[model samples]
Target: MCEDEKSLLEKAKNGDVFAYESLIEGYQKKVFNLALRMVGNREDASELAQEVFIRVYKSLKGFKEQSQFSTWIYKITTNVCLDELRKRKNRNITSLDEEIKLEDSEIKRQIEDDKPTPEMIVEKNELKKVVSDAIKLLSDEHRTVIVMRDIQGFSYEEIARIINCPEGTVKSRLNRARLALKEILKGKAELLSYEFVK
Candidate 1:
């Protein structure tokens, strides 16, 4: 976290609403992208983003100053995403695998704003969706490890703090997560229409 964010977090922890908004404003996209990646749905990600902020609001009072604000928020977001996943697992797993259908007209609708060819834009969106789906297949521990290390770019020590695990466990899980994702991607290359660079 930056010095400005650290200062804002201090105020937010003391029940300052404006400071809380400032804190959320600083990390909103990260929290949303993390949630979106975890759940693989725009609608679900939006709902999870709102819930994540509410969780942060409620938990601010109990937060210790030991961890970075990003680490702390990530811990909360990962846990909430995992919780949502568990709840969905008991209900229906297929919800996570549902395909996104963007109409051809939707692509043409963007022609005025987008300078890139329609095919390139569609490919970009598809790749993002593939990543999201690949993430959903990981075990909770592996999933959070990848999300923090690969997606969010946290140091292993930071991930250990966020996950409340030893550094060794963080490293082991991250390695396994990478391998699993690699295998899944290998199997999914046909669907993605291009193999990811090794």
Candidate 2:
């Protein structure tokens, strides 16, 4: 963390609400996106993101800075998301068809084709939906590794820290997650039609 961030963390830990908000502004979108991927819904992700920040604030004083602040925040994020998933599992409620809203810039980043043709736009949207659905079908462990390493772009070391596992285990789990995702995508005729699965 930079000196500026350390100052902000100190202020935030001292009960400065504005400082706390400022400290979290840079991380809000990322936390929300991670939660969205894990829970597969905007409403739930939004709630979970709020919960994460609250937990962070409550626990801020005890933060030992042994890990990067980002890593600590993400560890909280993944835990909150996984806890919600466990609760939802018992209830057995999931919605696969709810459209996931991503900014145009984010869409362009994730999709290789930069051309803005109407056909390409529609294809990109469909592809995103297909991939999101497949990801939702993964087991929690597989999905966590996939989202952290691939979509969220966290390094294996960072992911291992967030998930509290060995770095090699992170790599192995990611490999298995990719294969599981491919298998899930293969079962989707829509994805196959899009040439997303070989």
**Model 2 deviation from native, Cα RMSD in Å:** 8.6
Question: Ten residues in a row with the worst lDDT in model 2?
Answer: 103-112
Model 2: residues with Cα > 4 Å off, grouped in runs: 94-122, 190-198
* TM-scores for candidates 1 onward, in order: 0.73, 0.83
Model 1: how far is 119 from its true place, Å? 12
Please give, for residues 1-198, the per-residue lDDT of candidate 2 as tens digits.
888889999999999999999999999999999999999999999999999999999999999986789999999999999999889766766432232223210111122334343354357676687689778877788889999989999999899999999999998888877876776566554436467534
Q: What lDDT is reached at residue 181 by model 1?
A: 72
Stretches of candidate 1 exceeding 4 Å from the true structure? 1-15, 95-124, 190-198
Cα-based lDDT for every prediction: 0.73, 0.81
Local accuracy of candidate 1 as per-residue lDDT tens digits, 72-101:
788888888889988987898644443332
Most accurate candidate by TM-score: 2
Deviation from native of the Cα of residue 105 in model 2, angstroms: 34
